[model samples]
Target chain A: MTTQEPTNAENWAKPVDSLHIAHDLPDHAINLNVEGKRVASMTSGFGKMWQKTYRVRLDGARVAPQQVVKVWKEHFPEFWQKGQHFFGPMASISPGDVALINVKTGGVKLSTGILVLYADDVSFSFMTPEGHMFTGMITFSARELEDGVTQAEIVALVRAQDPIYELGMMTMGSGAEDRQWLHVLRSLAAHFGVEGKPTLEKICVDRKRQWKRFGNVRRSAAIRTVFYSVTRPLRRKEKTRASA
Target chain B: MDFSADVRQIDGLAVIDLHGEIMAGADDALTSGFVRATTGNTGPVLLNFADVSYINSTGIALIVGLLAEARASDRRILVSGLTDHYKDIFEITRISDFVTMCDDEESAAAAAKA
Candidate 1:
């Protein structure tokens, strides 16, 4: 993160910053669940860490890696699964931009956000905030295959922040995540008018859950967002004041 | 583009001296360095990043993969020579929670010995 060091590294990643204080939401984003939370990485969560990769082959497409990525970044939200919304800043993909997200896992509606951890011509990555369901980084990349085709991929290195998320993932939650990213890749491929069958690979990086981080459950976005939603009437004034 | 790892063992601990930036292309060198360090040694591994100049998010993921490999075999990995800034990255990523940090190789090795 040092400016004096490798320019390549600095170009790829922004200086690490933790979100400690709440900030006023932009007109495009919601303020719940993300304010006052720090960015959570793989090590911050309570569950066993996992490395999941979901990829699709954009066969018959003649797009270069950089071009695919350009389109991906420019229309990032368009590729997401239905019911999932990503609200980024007005500017294009760059280091340090935050994305306000509203997503659904199975039937549960969750509000959360992510930080743009790294970006370049061919790939970009997002890291979750502390209260988010997945605490780690998910990288999206478009690369040229050996056959001159483009392959769009999503690699998620994450751990569930708390027991709630871990349990949810164990049940239908994991599949939901898988489906979400698969849908994204397919949508990206469809943009090129190519049919894609995204493949998935998942690995458990660590099996022992850190019991010490059990307290993270208190910050679970699912619970917090639900609380925020149900009690909207009570906080309407505060919300209005913050906007003012 | 030029990354290297020099490994030396003390009291069954492997101390890896890393040089250059750890980014996407440093994979082979980093993984091979681990292989060399643990091929004959059974104790913990201590990474000395004093000479390392930079690391990107992908580089961080590669290290997490290494940690996963280490944990699978019951190997403890310690770290030393992380700049305050890089140390903060480790903390933000939560890798610090698993790996013990020491100011220098001597302490990391001794801690491993303990």
Candidate 2:
């Protein structure tokens, strides 16, 4: 076993003017709300900031931390719940890759994407882009505990991107977000033949909302998705008439 | 390289000199240094990354957490001595949007005074 020095700088993605999803995704993967969008961080969000952690310890699984992370990155999308679709890039989950996401929540389908900000042997992270439901970063990691247990964890530090998203978070969006990650962890553990029960910890980092960011609603992905869905028939008809 | 943080006062500013590869294990030292620098201090805190060798995603998140703490308390944070590469990383993460980035400790002190 060789311990490699962490070349952190090289592992990070180069700075981009805006996100561009270069990956060719499946037909089911909606690529909206991603291209030409800037990556949004905690400072650009509208609602109160929160740091959420979901952890699942592979109790009886015989896997090293690095092995767990490798598998997690390789099968990244496979762990997602049924309604959520993750379309990874051709090169897999490397840093700077842009992946499309199609999520179905409460019977409403929305499209968004994330920038793979950083990736290493034992961990990786993603940063949300503009018009995303939240403005933040989520890190996935696997580490060996003191008792020799390999623990897989997901940590999200985020804030709602706009007032509408904030309201939804206050209602059903927050629980849905929680369940999504929890399900992913459970599924990952189950993939290793372990029935892992995930634990969650939520902490509010900041109580004050950034009212200035309320204008971010102008780029709301949910609204755009709804509009796209409602006008699909009209677009199809126009295309047919033009071809005729 | 292991992470180490030393907090000191320079011209009324709490300047934390960080040395090492900042990864997951850096949470304790980083958080303690931040708390030590900001406790009872009304002025902006300067983080000097002149000697930093590496910084992973976890390290970035730790810095973001510190920034959140500072913002919550109405305090400011200024960063200095980041290599051009790290400067770009900060920009990509949008940490540059909230904190002032300086070329060196001297400039960071001057910015804090400003």
Candidate 3:
């Protein structure tokens, strides 16, 4: 059997760019101001017991931080579980700037995490948990592939310590959170100025397929657990009756 | 901040019309409403969305979560009367793919009945 050469479409499927922003962010995180409007106040750290860079994106914009915080409090419970917004009476954001916010957390410490931000038309912020803290930074350089769609190319680098290795971590979970960020990127792009239907369609199709695969895996796992649960007792009963 | 849900049985179908935005602090209400809508229903449930204008990621996640819960119970949940803006957001997130959408309350109710 002859194998067909992979097409440009297959090649374009890869991310355009990705960077470990957790490392390059300044220890004293920089303040993000949008045209004199303070959007978010972030703090960064390095070389701790966790060794991972950490940053906190406090919501501030034209809207009152209190109002945004209220909205966040009203809608997102998982964030509340992370910690109380003690930095100030700040709001996360409401109905603007962000199209979506996706978060992923796992591992023994549950300290490692990734937060992806999809702003307008291919803008993104990847926040990775380092050591015991999280770092926040923007990865601004992304280019469109021949498939005529754009993907994020993260350029930020870090040098303090390899948080993953420093933490003595062995495995990294799947980057499903990263893929969701890509979808948010595409949606933001379309929301702003990108007018390519095919590109948007391709992104949607890819996401649907990915979600379907995830669903299948979950369903199979559930089925297996249920099957074992149902049969375990039967085997015990059979052995008891046979011995009698 | 509080979610209020009213479920009326019309033509043997459960029509769940929700008022107020579904966000973080009010998850309990939303989850309870969904549970009530799907529980003990012999037929489909049509969710009326004309009044819901704003939903955060958590709110959207609740909808998905409810859908998954309903699916396990073999109950069908359909959304109707979504504004264009909300529809656009839902489309991108692909929530529409999992649940059916209708243009108006009547059609959604009818679909549920059928």
Candidate 4:
């Protein structure tokens, strides 16, 4: 094949030097941890890297890849189960947009955020920030197979960001993450009036952990989110006085 | 689209000749080529991107996976022939931090030797 560059190749999200949370939106339980942190790549993580894929074959729905992607991007938050919140400024995913996420787990609320890393017609991806549970990227895509079946898939290439996160993953963190996506796919399939049975495939891409990244614990979101939750009443009192 | 990688040795450096669009289904082939590139060598591996016409974010992540492998084995990776646009993507992802960038194969190979 010749080496001609793609003409008007689809628009990808622009590169960002770091993460900055948009503060114009209404304050929520998960908004505190994301305001000033920089996005973290897989190399910034402290644990072994793993790639987990969750896919649902949308057979009998006759949905094209573009259609699936269109709906997925526009209504991403609606598909999540109750109590898992995702708020993005744009109606669709774009490069450099930041999405705030607050997930409830183990009777505690965990606040974190994602930076929109890339977006195109058929796919989009998010990169995690420092202090998030996973430091890596999650790509959601829809494509038609050779057999003419359209499949929607989410691939998470992640590693724990610190020792605390690694321990959480070993205990219940990974399971919670898995169930959330499962709920999302099922909900999406249901919206299209198709029964979606998603299958999971996990691969341990790298076995060695970066012990040097143990310092990541200093920026742990879980710990900081807890602090914010504890100090919420004081903030509310201050706001009341300013209003008076 | 299909992606293929051909690994060739030049003065103890491995140069992977990459071709085609990089996206969802190209993971296995790239890994196979990377394994071949590192065999019987402890020196640097330089990727020849002269023929690579496109790369998505997933493709970038795939390259990061390879870089992680290279780092684990204590070998540096280099890239040559990336158009300015994709080179910008590398800068955005901060992948340029771990891998050395060059304009062409000759310069990359020279850097590998030095």
> How many clashes show up in model 1?
0
- What are the candidates' interface root-mean-square deviations? 4.0, 6.8, 17.9, 3.8
lDDT of 2 by residue, B45-97 (tens): 99998888788888888888888888888888899878888888899999999
lDDT at residue B69 of model 1 (Cα atoms): 76
DockQ of each: 0.39, 0.51, 0.01, 0.45
Worst 10 residues of 2 chain A by lDDT: A1-10
Per-residue lDDT of B10 in model 2: 95
lDDT of candidate 1 over B13-62, digit per residue (tens) = 88888999887778899999999999967788998898888887778888
Find the 10 residues in a row with the least total lDDT in model 4 chain A: A1-10
lDDT of 3 by residue, A198-237 (tens): 2212111011111222222222212333355568689889
Candidate 2 chain B weakest ten by summed lDDT: B65-74
Query: Could you tell which candidate, 1 or 3, scores higher by TM-score?
Result: 1
- Among residues 3 or more apart in sequence or in different chains, the pairs in candidate 1 whose N, CA or C atoms overlap within 3 Å are none
Tens digit of lDDT per residue, candidate 1, span A30-147? 4667655677756668888899999998898888889888888888888888778887765477766777888889577788988777788888888888889878888888777777
Candidate scoring better on TM-score of 2 and 4: 2
Model 2 interface DockQ: 0.51
TM-score of chain B of 4: 0.96
Clashes of each: 0, 0, 24, 1
lDDT (0 to 1) per candidate:
0.81, 0.89, 0.39, 0.83
lDDT of 4 by residue, A155-227 (tens): 8988999998888887888888889888888888887888999988998877888898999999988888889
